[model samples]
Target: MNIKPEGRFQVFANIVMILITLIAIIPLILLTIASLTDNSALIRNGYSFVPEKWSVYAYQYIFSSGNSVPHAYWISLVLTASGTLIGLTITTLLAYALSKKFLPGRGILTFIVFFTMLFSGGLVPTYINYTGVFGLKNTFLALMIPGLLMNAFNVMMMKSYFVTSIPEEIMEAANIDGANEFSVFFRVALPLSKPIIATIGLFIGIGYWNDWMNGYIYLTKRTDLYSIQNLLYRMIQNIQFLVNNSSSLTGADKSLGSIPSVSVRMAMAVVGVLPIVIVYPFIQNNFIKGITLGGVKG
Candidate 1:
């Protein structure tokens, strides 16, 4: 088949998209450079796309003794992995169950799930439940439990994907072949639903990874249980606290100016975000597929 003049337009559009992508990526490149540059150079000179003097001092400072960044990184990794796994499992199962037409009260159950997205108990009640009833405060559970697990939007996304992508005929065929509900789900549906599963997993994982509110409220004393993001926030807080209170605490001889505050803050930002930056591409492929599935008609 001979292509039409519109093919030339498609090429032009592609070039434009490439330009836009480059524009968007420039800041990220600069952030990487700033992370590597020394504090003195950064303050003396303005921000640069390329660093004149490259130093790993900021990263070294974060990893050095008396700093809890390494522990926080480990805590975040555990919480993110655990929360993503458990949350994805529960979301997939619940969404799959609700997707089936024969399941009784599925509509009501879905309503309850959807209701949460629109209205929540607010922060006070949630805090009370986590602290008072669950006693999750100052524990690893506090980091994993609240707001990260089984979001209604993720559940709905999975249900829609399963309904549209996985044919009911295939599920029926599996049922007829002496497969139980669990067997069919594990052997058939789960495998087929990889796109949505990966999509929701990424979303929930990122939420857990970036969460600071849960740590701030629930993990007041237990610095050991702090996630990377929360730890960074606390680090920034501590720096500011020192700067503000240094005159009173340290007297006139010592000053907070000696601390590499600017570089340290930027370094913390880089550290907190680096894991997500590294892991995003893998999940992003499935995330694109998941969104495409939602757009597809049954």
Candidate 2:
């Protein structure tokens, strides 16, 4: 049998894609195996796919405190949900208004939005303003409003999707039929924006879930408000500090039992990313479609 050039090219492409897929998945597999491996085995043999022994000590240490893990997870979930919802509403409304070319002062408004993407007030000023003027310090609102609440990039991405994908002719027809702007937007524009909405929501949700800085900074006085990321980060930091200073300490081995070793850190990482990895499959199709259809247009 003879193979055509196209068939040969397809075979080469499939081989390359399979290689890339394995490259992406191998690290995750190793990380999982390492997390399950006993700490002693991990230290002795380093990370391996097949460890001589397995242990759940790390997971036990993580949940050793009664409800702390669950509480942090709850806080992270709430923050992600609330931030994504509020952010989507504000971004979509702003992008929709900016998509209309005939709106009064549209050019200036668009420029201001674009300008924000280029320059931002430094962190100190932002912190001062949020703490002093907004009184957000040590509050749940502090975590919800700063950083991941909304972004100029998301607004621009959504604006591009609205302008290129949605036609003005449909809006004109709806207007001609005595439909108001609100009705047109609610009934027509939003339904047509599923792909972009899903894309933005996913981005915003991940940002909120993974954010430890906001909790670390603003919630210094309120440990109860810490998110899952913040909690895990603190756990890792404490473990590292103890390990680094173990020699200097008077009773190192006695106290080292409270701290987790390498396997525990890997376990924490696995726990941190588990929810996102599980959820990605549900949104994979929409995420792919959104990126394809929502590209920026010149």
Q: Rate the local accuracy (lDDT) of all candidates.
A: 0.83, 0.88
Candidate maximizing TM-score: 2
Off by over 4 Å in 1: 1-4, 246-255, 295-298
Q: Judged by lDDT, which candidate is best?
A: 2
**Error in Å for residue 32 of model 1:** 1.4
Cα lDDT tens digits, model 1, 6-30, are: 9988989999999998997887777
Candidate 2 residue lDDT tens string, 1-298:
9999999999999999999999988999999988888888899989999899998887988889443989999999999898989988998999899888889998899899888888998789999999999999999999999854358888888889999888889989999999998999999999999998999888888989888988888997898898999999988888898899999989987878655589988999998999999999999888877777777672
Q: For model 2, how big is the CA root-mean-square deviation?
A: 1.7
lDDT of 1 at 237: 87
Clashes of each: 0, 0
All models, RMSD in angstroms:
2.4, 1.7
**lDDT comparing candidate 1 with the true structure:** 0.83
Error of 2 at 208 (Å): 0.3
